[model samples]
Target: MRIRLQRDIDRLKKQVVSLATLVEERFRLAIRAVECRDADLARKVIIGDAEIDQKEVDIEEECLKILALHQPVADHLRYIISVLKLNNDLERIGDLAVNIAQKAEVVASKLELPIPFDYVTMSQRAGEMLEESLNSLVNLDLHLAYRVCAQDDEVDFMKSAMQLQFAEEIRKAKEEHIEPLIHLFLISRHLERIADHATNIAEDVIYMITGEIHRHKGFEYHHSEE
Candidate 1:
């Protein structure tokens, strides 16, 4: 029974990792769609989301089967729980990528609109955080997970700065520019949400590694000004 459980857990890890890889790819494509202002590319990301949705369902079913059949104990039980938690986070991240793609679809139509925020930098930061968070999970590295959690505030700060910039831009823009500016603001919001999900995944990794409930303890490192 123990041998069978380990086999199932190993298979679960590969499956979840495959899903993560696909999600990361979609996220990168969504970012490119925004950067290149390609509506078609954005639509590709949107349409491809069905794949993610299907994978999420499949992973959930697998988790349930493992729990029912194996009744994992202690460390094994924690790992299964962590996978269940991170599976949702990964799926939500995929949805957030679709949201970004949808915004890119809108912004792509208005080529002349001047972007007021440093969205490129913000998107890059969010993407890095996401990749690193998944890395923490793959390695079950507690320190890496903590580092990813600490970086969440930086993305939050960037989003807040974007809000201020967008407010000023909206005040200055004509009626025609207002609509696309709103979409750009939403794109920034989506990126921040992705970062948030990434942080959640990292926290789950921490839980898996140490069996410690690290959420909402306010232990995350903060920037000097934050």
Candidate 2:
């Protein structure tokens, strides 16, 4: 019975890692599609989204099976619950990537807008956060999870800058350019949301490691107050 429980645990971890890999690949592809305005690659991302969705469903089933078979208690129970929540977050992040790809397709169909701002830095940072958060989950590292939470501010700042630049472009440019501008804005929003999901996953990792919930309270409580 113990060996069987160990196998289930190992299987659950492998499934989560696989889901993370797919999500990371989609994120990279989405960014490339945006940068190169490659509708074909963007279409590929949209089509591939279903696979990620299926993986989430499979992970949930595995979690349920383990719950019923092993009836995990205490830390094991917490770990399964965390995995369920993280699985949802991972799937949502994949959807955000799909949204970015949709924006890419929209931009590809139109005349290329003038070079105003590059999303390369923003994309890179968000992608790094996603990767690190997943790594933290696999390693069960609370410190790295906290680092993921801290990096969210940088992603938010980049998103704000992109929004401002796009707003200025709208003021100065012709009406026809508005379509591409909207698409670019959507892309930024999707990237921002991806970072948000990564933050959620990091918080879940912390909970899994420490058995404490910190979602609504925020990190400020960790240091304060009188």
Candidates' lDDT values, in order?
0.91, 0.88
- Enumerate residue pairs that collide in model 1: none
Best prediction by TM-score = 1
For candidate 1, the C-alpha RMSD (Å) to the true structure equals 2.6
Residue range 1-226, candidate 2, lDDT tens digits: 8788888999899999999999999999999998888999999999999999999999999999999999988888899999999999999999999999998898887755754666888888989999999999989989999999888877877878888998898899778888788888878878888988898899999999899996756553343220
Model 1 residue 76 lDDT score:
95
Give one clash count per candidate, in the order shown: 0, 0
Off by more than 4 A, model 1? 219-226
Per-residue lDDT of 1-226 in model 1, one digit per residue for the tens?
9999999999999999999999999999999998899999999999999999999998989999999999999999999999999999999999999998999999998888867899889999999999999999888888999999888888988988999999999998999999899999988988988998898899999999899988776644333222
CA displacement after TM-score superposition, residue 112 of candidate 1 (Å) = 1.0
What TM-score would you give candidate 2 relative to the actual structure?
0.93
Cα error, residue 21 of model 1, in Å, equals 0.6
Off by over 4 Å in 2: 219-226
